[model samples]
Target: MVRPLLRQLLAMAIVGSTAGCLITDRVEFEDPENLPPLIESMAPPAAKVVRLDRTRSEDVSFACQVLDQNEEDTLDARAFLDFARDEAIRGVTEVVQSESDARRRSVTASFPPDLFARGCHVVEVDVIDGGAAGWDPGGQTRFRSVKEGVAKATATWFVLAYDSEGDPRADISLESCP
Candidate 1:
């Protein structure tokens, strides 16, 4: 009789455990297709920037590639050339124009002796597009845009002079400059 009672208890426990396993409830999530089109359109639009390179040298150079919104519309090439000429007359002492083998559309302006003293300094470069011109300040150089009149994109780079001859001999240990 005890054995029969133990078997009945084990059977009751098994049935109780299996009861939970047999339960099923369906869950559903709303489809994205049901959402309004404006909800997806609220996302930010794609953005892009012009490529620029900054290098330190006793002599500096400027290189730029024409930008194109489409195959039919390209940044004016002559505008860049004119800007290069003007920069040479300004702070840039020497300028050399070269064509890149990698991209046929780029022009470079090389400066033989970059005009700046070796030290920590701020330089300004300008970005010019059509009638608007803006300046970008860099610790060592400035980028400027040179194009004027029609909306053409142009940028100028300013380089800070660094003395690569040797390590700085002296430095101030003060908490801050007065």
Candidate 2:
């Protein structure tokens, strides 16, 4: 059985042996007195939509965008995205490319249909912002866009608080952008 629906991806698959499989996709928010990691996403995260062109001129497009999740009016420093693999860059699609409008704070990319025809997954999404120094590692989140099969056209966004050396940390958890 299959059902069609539209919803935002605000959680991730917690990978662990003790945690077990089939984890719920939701952020464990704390209390109101506390705070959470701001999503900093301009628009709602989507299940990669296959843009259509009846005249046969459509293309697969994705905008590597960044903004002040807490304040949409503000612009983030620099952000990047990987939509082909999670571990390595195979050159099947663009890799580690900066956004188009870094100063304005976003990157809109248009690719040939063949790229989406082959399908893709998330490698990493990172932001460089001014924390304590002039530049610092902001945070990271992963995303995956399925093209075919059961989860076709669906996107999943997950959270991770790893440092520059990839060390896990505990402090904040961002659900989705405003």
Candidate 3:
């Protein structure tokens, strides 16, 4: 009789655990037709000219406005500067500033004026949506928009040469090295 009672208790526990799995209150389902983030505009437009003083220093700021169709989805933005000669600038920080809504974000990136010499630098902005195209399990969320929810924009920075007197010269050349 004791063996029968124990067997019934074990069966009840199994049923209770299986029933809990069927409860998907915490599971989040996403739309498979989610759209990628869009870059609406960027500051310091393409082919922008910058006259920098060798003696004085100032930060070069790059910003972008990104928009995502999915309002609930989170977005991230990054910016980088690369020289025309395949040399990329390092230590540039990309800061993403989000508004009250999650659909739009303003991203700013900057590098010290000393980091860039006289040359044409290509500034690229990349915006990515927090992959909401897949479902989220009960415990943790999963990301699957590896290639779908991404956008990129590119602009050119023309840092003009300065004379010994700290005067900006009219040099439009892209040579960074002597």
Candidate 4:
């Protein structure tokens, strides 16, 4: 009876190890407190989305752009735009890639007249490949949109930081011009 039990235990162990052999698709990101090595050293960190408000009758708009400070479009600009559009709260516009630098990537999202509201709007500011860590077609920086009241009439900013291991360490929230 003892011998049979030992064999059974060995078989179970082998099976468990084999099952865990496959790579698990998990990527860890940071909040606004911690940032990657590359960004942390760069002069003047990128701006954040504070608050967004707009009027419906004119060209009242905000620029949603991304800047690749490394002088190359290392991150997927298109993907970041999609994330902003899909994740932005109501009254938020699309994110557009604006500039690239030797050490940074920036994107600006505009608030169109149709989407602009009167209160504090929520916005998610995702800095795609902030550190040029790597090209991850399946990776992204995600965080909750800044929550502000519609009547406050104040702007805010949020930043998502990442590292080479594809891990984010900080997510920042800031106030912006109306």
Candidate 5:
């Protein structure tokens, strides 16, 4: 039969041209000198429901916009607020420097809305990139054994609780902003 259909169409055209030149030595990527810190943008956004007016004192901010390709290192931004927490409240970072972008950075975190009490919180933003040597300056090891630049960002709001003609209590708390 025409020489077995011309040797099965020349063995399917040589296995479809060598199957895209199968080359594999375990190739991975993303290592432009340990690249890590890059949050881009974050604020009272990412679920957003915030409406806590226990009488309004104001001071519940959190912002982010960190980007680092190792642009001279030094960038430790942090902000956390879990709420139904056994621990996790820390928020008082304020590193600013990006009038245009020297590699970008503008992290702001301020809390004190009574440390949030009405429910559903979770707003973590961490951007660390001091060039990561792991940091163990002999303080007996204060953590961060090695996380290679580290970058984290999360947001989820909902402090609602205001029903005395203040309007903001439609009762929506399945409780899970962890």
Candidate 6:
């Protein structure tokens, strides 16, 4: 099963990287179909599990292939398997996952490090009795929360313009500072 998953992942990576030069600012985790045709045989027709982490929650072997939606930007430059609670901001395990340069268009980023030189971190969620799960492109990402205050992870995007001093600060998001 693991071998098949890895093969599928590899095939996706090759297709993504070689299809063409990226020219926009988009993020994807496989292309053409953008996902495996099926995950579990019983899974719904619409569901494709692109990346999965099953078994132990405390120690995860995280790996995934990602695509740069466009060639003009670096959205794929920073990829992460972020696990957090409802509160967010805090009590989150922001693993500094790696990526190939958006210059490359697509990459297979992993915690163990390959493709890109980006860094990775050891994440330990404080909550062990419970876990959380999140997905983009729907039904792709499945993670068992090691433990965190967040009931689960949700999607939110924010960008920071110039601050009061006109200096850029990523901490100061434009979304009313929320």
Specify the highest-lDDT model's number. Answer: 5
List ranges where model 3 is wrong by over 4 Å.
1-32, 83-97, 130-178
Q: Over the stretch 67-116, how does candidate 5's per-residue lDDT look in tens digits?
A: 77667677665456663353443853666777776788887777766766
Q: Tens digit of lDDT per residue, candidate 1, span 1-178?
A: 9999999999999988878555568879774331110111101111211111223334344555433233222222221222332432233212112243211234344444434333322222222222222222331222343322323333433333334434352232222111
Q: What lDDT would candidate 6 get against the real structure?
A: 0.28
Question: What is candidate 4's local distance difference test score?
Answer: 0.35
Distance from true location, Cα of 150 in model 4, Å: 34
Q: Residue by residue across 1-178, what tens digits does model 2's lDDT show?
A: 1222222221223333246566678989864331212223422254332222222345434444443222222222222224333332222222232355323344344434333222222323333332213222232322222112111111123222122232333222343211
Question: Each candidate's TM vs. the true structure?
Answer: 0.30, 0.27, 0.53, 0.30, 0.27, 0.19
**RMSD per prediction, one decimal?**
16.9, 26.3, 16.1, 18.8, 14.8, 26.1
lDDT of 4 at 100: 41
Candidate with best TM-score: 3
Of the candidates numbered 2 and 5, which has the greater lDDT value? 5
Error of 3 at 60 (Å): 1.4
| lDDT by residue (tens digit), candidate 4, 43-146 | 12236443222322443323333333334333322211223346423332232333443544334344344443333333333333433333233424333221
Rate residue 6 of model 4 by lDDT. 100
Ranking by lDDT: 5, 3, 4, 1, 2, 6
Pitting candidate 1 against candidate 3, the one with the higher lDDT is 3
Worst 10-residue lDDT window, candidate 2: 146-155
The clash numbers for all candidates, in the given order, read 18, 2, 0, 50, 0, 9
Q: Estimate candidate 1's alpha-carbon lDDT, on a 0 to 1 scale.
A: 0.32
Q: Give the range of the ten consecutive residues with the poorest summed lDDT in model 1.
A: 35-44
Task: Please provide, for model 6 over 1-178, each residue's C-alpha lDDT reduced to its tens digit, 9 standing for 90 to 100.
Answer: 9999999999999988899666987876664321211111111111222222222133222222222233332221222333332222222333222354432222222232122122222221221112123222232332332222222212222212221333333233233422
Candidate 6 to truth, TM: 0.19
Q: What is the lDDT of candidate 2?
A: 0.30
Provide the overall lDDT of each model, using Cα atoms, as 2-decimal numbers.
0.32, 0.30, 0.54, 0.35, 0.58, 0.28
**Model 3 lDDT-worst window of ten:** 135-144
